[model samples]
Target: MFFVDTIELSGLGNRSYLAGGARTAVAVDPPRDIDQVLAAAARRGVRISHVVETHLHNDYVSGGLELARISGAVYLVPAAAHVSFERTAVHDGDTVEIDAGLTLRALATPGHTPHHTSYILEDSGMAVAVFTGGSLLIGTVGRPDLVEPRLTKQLARAQHASVHRLAAELADDTTVLPTHGFGSFCSSAQAAGTATTIGREKEVNDALVRDVDTFVADLLAGLEDIPAYYAHMGPVNAAGPAPVDLTPPALADAEDIAARLAAGEWVVDLRSRVAFAEGHLAGSYNFDADGQFATYLAWLVPWGKPVTLLAGSPEQLAAAQRELTRVGIDRPAAAAVGGPASWIREGEEPASFRRATFADLADRRASGDVVVLDVRRDSERADGHVEGSVHIPIHTLHRRLDEVPAGEVWVHCAGGMRAAIAASLLDAAGREVVAVDDGFRSAEEAGLTECGSHGDGGPTA
Candidate 1:
């Protein structure tokens, strides 16, 4: 019997699959850290015979090349992908045989990227599952705008055709497994369902239910802030990412931390937002581990800038390092474990900012002047937000500081984590800031927001 195991990279909001018979398997769209893939294969008692990528991902560094090399498997990449590495280039209609009467068939589905493909896993020639990577998501198709801006419209049209083709060819019972859509920015829009099938998709998937023009228009319009770090992912994947290094960086002391900060390097604290707001090194920024640490940290920090990680414990530091490595922030310049006290000299007091709720924001607004900064994405802000708050997505907040009107800044997001990150940046820049440590829903309940609107944008952080 063929078995399929999913490797969920929850931090990245992507999943890699390992599937085959009891003895042999194939891994699809693995992440940069292949150790988890290796462990899953070990648990399944299967030998990985093929490692394949559905596309050159624009989200995380691909571990397919290295995994194939390590497992002694044939690395299959789409033929149209412009890559410098040697591999068994696959095309539409190409099939890879597996043990025990199983097979994987490649079908061209270019929408998310120029060469995106979906792989159908078959048992005895009966279609059972299709690995629709970045093409057919749980309820929507992957975004078509990641490639070239000039090719976006063309890609949207292509994306529409691709999902339709899959729906037409695949059996209604075919299990539709996708790599994007589960909170990954690769999705054209947010997808909430835990599981979905091709048959179920026909009833709900916009690409399948709507006309090409309508689907394209809505998809394009809903596209929000593309993470700044995405610019590096495609190139890294095409060039074949180097093996990940999870070795802990050398320790940093107060002197080294001070010097790094003085030199303008990022000193990130991977603590809880509440703890960070209570106390943190003056120049150190909080891209707390309790949030989408990798996405936001990589999104805001300028590429190639050295970063020193500080965490409450060694475990937190190591965990943050693993997440960062997946996004190509391969090494921490230095790392420190312990609280703010350990990070500063005896006489030095850690920097801090006030933590307030939406109710507090309302109370403070009534008594004194404050600038309300909403650091949610444009897509989220559109769903309804604080009526007149300064809107700047957290990813763009670093460069758009000047746009924030002057005053004691009270920042908030769909949740408090992103707001804490924004508050840290604003705090470090000498602005009086208060992190709204509450849900956006409370903003309306507390009369701080009037989103005469449809729904909340879920928890973006």
Candidate 2:
């Protein structure tokens, strides 16, 4: 009896699984890095019988199709798979029997999207492990607003029903193994680090504690703005992502990078947002390397199109390349050999951002003039937050920019990722924005408690 489960954590913190009884294994929600999954399975001496996608993920391109193509395994999806592909679409209650006694039962849990589903493993009488795609997480349920606006209500209804259904049907001890983990933008209430059981989550999940109406309101309130590239990814993934070839083009001199850019290739700046803002290739896309870089680049850079990497150094180029490859942007037109300065000498450059430390933001907040924008998720805000700070949750900042006053506004995240993004958006929108370099934690440590610590990001002053 092989009851062992191997969880592979991708660089971006996505969890893909290889689970089975013995010789047969099932891979779920795999990223574009299929080779890593395969390598792990080979070490365990198990044959990958099926590649499964719980739903059409908007965050990262699924590699299940490509893995199936290369390994001759069956690719499995839900019945709502409207995309044209050679796949086995299972219904809400369909069962995929893996071996003599091992089986996985699909449950239609459509809240994140209309087609989302979850799986329950059955080995003996009842299974205790449920593979929740985005319907349920350790500390929160999936965001209901990812679908259509009208669908948000319906999805909320379905989401509540689905979670309650799981709570009612499954045993309390059932382990919840989810795809999205803590840092990913998929769920706001994702547990900080550890996995949780259904029993524990039922007691703590804020969305579950409230009635459906309150749940809907709470769910929608302060939801982060979906990324710019999220909409562009769904169609591409559904249609089957074009194959990625990692072999870089023949030695084109540093000058050739400009030719590639002029030829319609996009040069993606992989440095921090502040670094790019300071100075970069004028026309390069400002997709920083820190947060969700590969995920965004997949949509921003077309497959097979030339892309030049503008990273910190030669060491960063390989890392940047790997991140790009995760989402299938494996080719490099060429890396900026001489760095950003190389491009500037060629007369092509991009803008950079101005950064302020926690001390700087605190001083500004003390003046009672600067609007403190906390860009963390709503759940994080609810935990505890900086006093008197306006909450926009990063994602919704653009749509609600009018709400933020025109004067100097200090922006920050739990650490610094969302703050950087929010600051960039504000700067692009012609607002005076300063990103707090140290973020909230630093403010607390510095003993600047003008604003009580609410456990959110940092204090306003």
Candidate 3:
């Protein structure tokens, strides 16, 4: 008998897997943080015999090489990855036997990347599940634009074919487990569920339902700007990622935090959106320590720049550090764990802004006292935004700050999380900020005039 265990990297919006019969297991698409995988293997009383990479990941650093090295497991990668490390290079149709009555067969499923592959798990001769990585996700296929921009169209077409190939070759009852698209930007479309069967995907997956040309066109047209940190992940993974450092960062005093800030380093406040809006360091940006913290922070901060974390508690600091390390933002310059009152005790005045609901902002706008600032992605804004809101995506706000007109800037996104971050930035820049800490839908419900065509971007809820 064989079983599969899903390890959710919820912060990254991705999943890794462990599958085997009884005595041994194989890890698929593991994260840079290997402790969780090790813990899972230990709990199962199974030795990790092999670690596999479906492709070179572009969203976060991979722990496959380090995990394999520490466990004496065979490291297997697709022959086409062209990685500069020692490993077993596998090709399409290659099979590897595991302990008990299990085997893994590689299938070429290019699209997310040129070397992308999917694995079919079999017990004896019966197909059990397919680990589809980024090729075939829960509801849609992986976005093809993460690679060279010139190859996006080619890859999109290939993605369509690759998904069909899986549908044709795999059994209807076979489970489909994918590594991307849970919430990550790597997914071309929103996933309908976390896990599905081959039969279910065949009946519903958009890539499998549409013609190759239409799939390619829709995919290319839907891609938004990839995160800035993504540009650094591929090269780091190709060379091999260093083992993650989980040690709690050194605590910094008010003077040290002030020096780093003076040198223009990022000081991120990992608190609740509301807490951050109420009070924080004058120059620190707010990326609440929950819900896609790593993704948004990595997207906004420049690559390789030094960063310092400001958290309200020790646990918050640790959680923020763990997420940051997953995206290769290792070794924060320093950390300060306390609320705004602590800093104020050190004689620095804490910064704060007003938190308003969509209805309040609508009333203010009608009175001509507020400038609506929509900080959602262009794709999101295209879906529909508050009418007459100044548009600037959060990721680009640092460079585009000058474009916002002078007024009481009322900042918002699809929801309040991003609005709080933008409000912090605007407040830090000496602009009067009022965070519209409510859902985008509330703007319409509050009778605020709305504009923009409806797009594929889903609702905040």
Model 3 residue 194 distance off true place after TM-score fit, in angstroms? 1.9
Clashes of each: 0, 18, 0
lDDT of each: 0.90, 0.71, 0.87
> Which parts of model 2 have CA positions greater than 4 angstroms off?
3-13, 249-266, 272-290, 295-307, 313-315, 325-334, 341-343, 346-355, 361-414, 418-435, 441-454, 458-461
Top candidate on lDDT is 1
User: What are the per-residue Cα lDDT tens digits for candidate 2 across 1-120?
Assistant: 545354555445568787776687788887776777888788878888888898887776788898888877778888796777889997888888765688888988888788888988
Highest TM-score scorer: 1
**Stretches > 4 Å off in candidate 1:** none
Comparing 2 and 3 on lDDT, the stronger one: 3
Candidate 2 global TM-score: 0.78
Return the candidate ranking by TM-score, descending: 1, 3, 2
TM for candidate 1 is: 0.98
